[model samples]
Target chain A: MKAPDFSYFEAQNIEDAIKYKSEDDEAVILAGGQSLLPALNMRLSSPSCLIDISKINNLNEIKIEGDFINIGALATHSDVMNNDLVHEKLPCLVDILKMVAHAAIRNKGTHGGSIAYGDPAAELPAFAVAMNAEIVLSGLSGQRIVNAKDFYLGLFETDLKSDEILIAIRYPLLDVNQHLIFDEVCRRHGDYAMAGLMAKVELDQSKINNLDLVYFATGDKPNVGQNTAKLVIDDGYDYEKLKKSLASEIDFAGDLNSSSEMKLHLATILINKILNKLER
Target chain B: MSAKNSVNISFSVNGENFDDVTVPTRQHLADYLRSQGLTGTHLGCEQGACGACTIEMDGVAVRSCLVLASQANGSSITTVEGFDDEVMQKVKNNFLKHNAFQCGFCSPGMLMTTKEIISSKKKLSRDEIRSEISGNYCRCTGYQSIVDAIEETINEIN
Candidate 1:
């Protein structure tokens, strides 16, 4: 139940951290150690060195820059959940944050680490994709910004280079006429979602102008329900009939938590439940 | 500076400062605490799921097993044995009054998480309390007694 022997380096800054990564190909960055420590304890991953970046200055800040809210990589789920900026600017994220694992896990699990880990069942990555956020990656070469929809490639796979570190994520602010909903069904409250949805809708005079739905934990990546969104919006947000047509529209794959067929069935029920509340 | 396998760490536990103690970098805070004879912090599902190793680090409750001792080098940790406050005393008394445990393995971490909720000064509903302590799992007692105890404690304090 102990992590394997590995050298530790407490990085002084982003440059210093990238320098270490550049020097060692098998080094892993330690953000909040929520996921990495568990992997290390289970011996699932045996990196030669662990780079502790918790001490890096200016990496855990949440700031509102222009029309976007920028969250640093080291910002914990608790930080994002409790931040007034997040509540006022992106309440959809707050809704998802509240449902993220328990308080203790939220206290230690970081936003960047969660995004970097890229678990398809996780909330932050799904939220990022639904918001069309931007992921900022920093390396010795400099910084590059990738759209959230393109950041994640597959299960536990991301576009982040080995030598690059996720510095921050910028989410575009929701317009005054835009409304969002994030909901999931798990066996237990703190457990991973069996299937979830993060929906963003732009409404003009109670009529839907645009709608986007990102389904999580039902596929290899956070899948955008493009056909369902188009159909539902075209049907005037009438989820009653629209949901019945969604089983064939969205693609789902089975996992231990749920079966593919069940997830397809549950997605309709869950989306309808959320839309019902919105209508009420 | 050359990286050393073992580094000297200094931290405060229960209001006492122990400085410059050499420890392996990979040692978890829970294991380190137990090694120092503070066995109240129990370990269950060391992967941070069970939450038996929860402790207060700089006033935030965190799973100690997931946190490296080296990460807690400068942190002030308060374990279950060192919890001495009026609110915690009330909580402890409520646990006894409510018979909150059959097996004491999860008590220490449960109490730590409970303390955090009380200190936060929120008016959490019954379901909210359950959600708040969902991280701490108790195999025995079916958790109703624990919830009753917490609610009773909050009601008394208010």
Candidate 2:
């Protein structure tokens, strides 16, 4: 299917993109175009204008800034996957990115675009929540930062306003004792996961000190298992007990492939899998 | 159509420069390439799922079906017809030797993605090769021959 006709404007910088977006209420920002183009081609979305921000300079940088790693919005998944900083500091991101789509898609798909698109099945958003990442948004009114947890509202929905542009994401550097584990169950290697989990664990003297578990594809948005995390910390890590408690914590949603019950089962399996890895 | 619905883009395709080419904003890169008679870039799925329309944009493999023609301005693109290097030649020969494709609709994308995997210079096992090319579906060959062909090419190159 061909995309519907729309006006296009190539913005030279962030300000230009903001200005162009401000002029039209129906204008949509074009990042890597990996997801948006597909939506457009399928006619699922049709906007009056497309603000192309791929050419914005300094909008694709992946660099370390003091205590956080600042990933520019336009940075492609390939760029993030191959960066030495991400490799050394956030290896879990590299691990999850390997399972994201394929090489061709990753070569063009942007990191911030994934978060902005707010697909509940996507791994990045769950990762952002697990790592306590901060999302930076810019609009005509200046800029504001939103925590990754609060940024996601519902299915394919985000706190991103139509006039605001996602500029960068800041992920705090992991402490020496902290470890991150991510795993997903999908039909194929690159397909969206039926259920996935990203866990950040910090162990103090062989006891779970801090545990954060974020599940994707099992709910409307990234489902933070706050109660489950509390259970693990309070009662220690017991697979049977934790599995029994998960059903009540997360309100699993059914999809075309997996039912809500099946998703809950898969989510429990992922939790057990991640916990085993953390114990090792 | 109004002038606002179209964009003038200049880009390079297979080492050939195209300047001031006007295209509809709705047209994707795959359609744009086909319009220029570069039909080798197939379009199995207009969406990014099927890798039949994969091409090299600035030395990276991407789904042309998902890239807008207007967004490709000033970029260098290489289609399956652009392969003339020794490595690509060897890859083609290996594909033929292994009978990697049947129906041949997926060959261009398979070749383009295989070229990328090989160029990565990583020592990939057969399982890794299969995983790397998972995006490019080959319904006819069942992917055994394709993996064999890519594995042979990597062994030869290494």
Candidate 3:
């Protein structure tokens, strides 16, 4: 399939990319092209001009800047795994990161690109939301930061303006006492998760302290399940009690892969998987 | 807009520089590379779901069919054909040892995927290795052998 006719300009840096994008009304930033490329080829989106931003430096680094781990927008999945900060500080991020499609696609796909692509089934965004991470977006006039909760409006939609390019995503570090357990059910090993959950829990003796749950691929948008998290904390020690809540109260939805009932069932199964592991 | 049809773009395909290729803005990197006689990169799903068109551009592996030819200007590319790296040979041996290829359409992309993994030297567990190769789909249902191949290759390299 051929994309619609357009002009391409290789931006020397992010400034040039932003400048060119600001100057034109119909231009889109090209990163890994994992999602955008397929969309353009499938005739889903046809921009008048393309701005390639591969040459931008430092946009691919995962740095520990004080209390937050700053993941650059251009940072590839391979880069994330290689970075010492991410591996040490937020290696829980690795569990979810490792679940992305394949090595080839991850090497080309970027952190900002996946968050920008806003695939509800994507593990990263769910992680971002679970961690209450914030996105840094830069447009012609200035830059704005939006929490992951607000960044996602709908399926494949973000608050980003076409003129703006996402710069990075930052999240506060979880405490040493916190244990994270992530579980996703994919048709196969590497495909998009049919249903996934990233849960952060802290146990005080035998009682659950905080049972925060975030699930993806269950609906058109990620359900933070703040209520479910609270309920899990209150009744979490008994896995069966929380398991029933996950199945009944979570209210999961589905897309092309499964049904609403199936999504909900898978979500509960995945949540149980996490709870069981951490319980060990 | 028809007047702005042709744009000169440059990309390094199979580790060689071809700075004079002028392609339509709509042309895909997969098409451009194949047109340049680098037919090693196979095409399977035509969508991002399959890794058949996997290639490294500017050190990052991407779906060639999804990338516009113009997007790859000044980028370095690596493909399966004409690959002679030791790790690549080891990956081939892994496939041979495990007999991973049935249809073989997915093998080229798998090799490319494995190439990216070995180059980084990132610590990979069995679970990570399995997830990393998930982008490529094999219809022959030979994933066990495929994973075995990658594991063997990884072990040989160490």
Top TM-score hit: 2
What is the overall TM-score of model 1 with all chains considered together?
0.94
Candidate 1 or 2, higher TM-score?
2
Model 3: C-alpha RMSD to truth?
A: 3.5
Model no. 3, DockQ = 0.51
> lDDT tens string, model 3, A86-105?
88899888867777876666
> What CAPRI grade goes to candidate 1?
medium
Error of 2 at B50 (Å): 1.2
TM-score of each model, in listed order: 0.94, 0.96, 0.86
By TM-score: ranked, best first: 2, 1, 3
Stretch of 10 with least lDDT, candidate 1 chain A: A236-245
**How well is each residue in B1-158 modelled by candidate 2, as lDDT tens digits?**
12267889899999999999999988899999999899999998898998999999999999999999998999999999997699998998998998886799999999999889988898899999988889998868559989989999999999
**Cα RMSD for candidates in order:** 2.1, 1.9, 3.5
lDDT of 2 by residue, A1-280 (tens): 9888898888887887887787788888889988888888889998998888899899899999999999999999999998999898888888899989999999999999998988899999999999999999999899999999999999888998767999999999999888888889999899999999999999898788999999999999999988888887897667677777888887889999899988888887787788788777
lDDT of 1 by residue, B12-106 (tens): 99999989998888888899999999999999998998989999998899999999988888889999988988888899888998899668999
Ten-residue segment with the worst summed lDDT in candidate 2 chain A? A235-244
Off by over 4 Å in 3: A23-26, A237-251, B1-6, B58-61, B85-104, B114-133, B141-158
